[model samples]
Target: MSSFENVTVLTKANVYFDGKVTSRTVQFADGTKKTLGILLPGEYEFGTDVKEIMEIQAGELNVLLPGSTEWITISGQGEFTVPANAKFKLEVKTVSDYICSYIAE
Candidate 1:
């Protein structure tokens, strides 16, 4: 989907990595939540409390998923899933746009 509708977005941004990574919470009617964000070329590590699907809308990046030795490269658009209670690493090569959906275990 190019955009989201019928959702409520929080005004406050979720800032991380000294403002290099920022996202806003988007709440849906079904009680599901997602984050729309941008990553400005940097390395970042994140831990998840729930399963997450990261949809890369635009940009280039390498992802090291939990327990993976390989770094998956995404140049334009891609998607990856991270299990709950796991940590993943990212090396963003360019300004990246993404949507992250949090799923219950």
Candidate 2:
């Protein structure tokens, strides 16, 4: 991972857990392959397991889950749990980072 300004640049795509971005390949329903990237702190609405991917273009933030009725905030670290085909939003708390999050859906 690389950091420029306040955003961390992702070297390889992987699964996001807690505060760690691991190296792995995520498959979507449409069969698109994506290598994960930097996860800027915030809220993300991953519509569901089928929604495939999310590209967060900001840093330090709050995220709204796709199908849920709640707003979650992340300071230094956070995790994203996506069900199949969920749609959501991200509320950036600090400067934003450009994270390319992709899924198979």
Candidate 3:
């Protein structure tokens, strides 16, 4: 995973699924933002307002991406994308750490 040295934090954090997932937003020097988070072992469905790239930093995730029937397994150091205004489901077999980058539409 890449480090965000000298980045600015958004000053607010996000919690989802009753705290099963939580993230803090940070902005790069170029004005790009990303959320760094962790997910406990469980199933979760997420919706995106913009295109998102989810990069796994630790543990494993089984993901059912939009427009797909098969669940793809992504381990630590892997990544996946979800389109704008779309949804995807994830099944975590172990505690998972991730970084999500949002792409402007």
RMSD of each: 1.0, 10.3, 1.4
- Candidate 3 residue 39 Cα shift, in angstroms, is 0.5
Q: For candidate 1, write residues 1-105 as lDDT tens digits.
A: 468899999999999999999999999999999999999999999999999999999999999999999999999999999999999999999999999999996
Q: Candidate 3 clash total?
A: 0
Candidate 2, residues 1-105, lDDT tens digits: the string is 543233343455545545433344444445454444554445443344453444444346677776567887666555565556557676666654443355443
TM-score of each: 0.97, 0.42, 0.92
Give the RMSD in angstroms, all C-alphas superposed, for model 2.
Answer: 10.3
Identify the runs in model 2 with alpha carbons over 4 angstroms from their true place: 1-58, 98-105
Residue 51 error, candidate 2, Å: 5.9
In candidate 1, stretches whose alpha carbon ends up further than 4 angstroms from where it belongs are none
lDDT of 3 by residue, 44-75 (tens): 99999999999999988899999999999987
Ranked candidates, highest TM-score first: 1, 3, 2
- lDDT score, candidate 2: 0.51
Best by TM-score: 1
Worst 10 residues of 3 by lDDT: 1-10
Please report, in order, the local distance difference test score of every candidate based on alpha carbons. 0.97, 0.51, 0.91
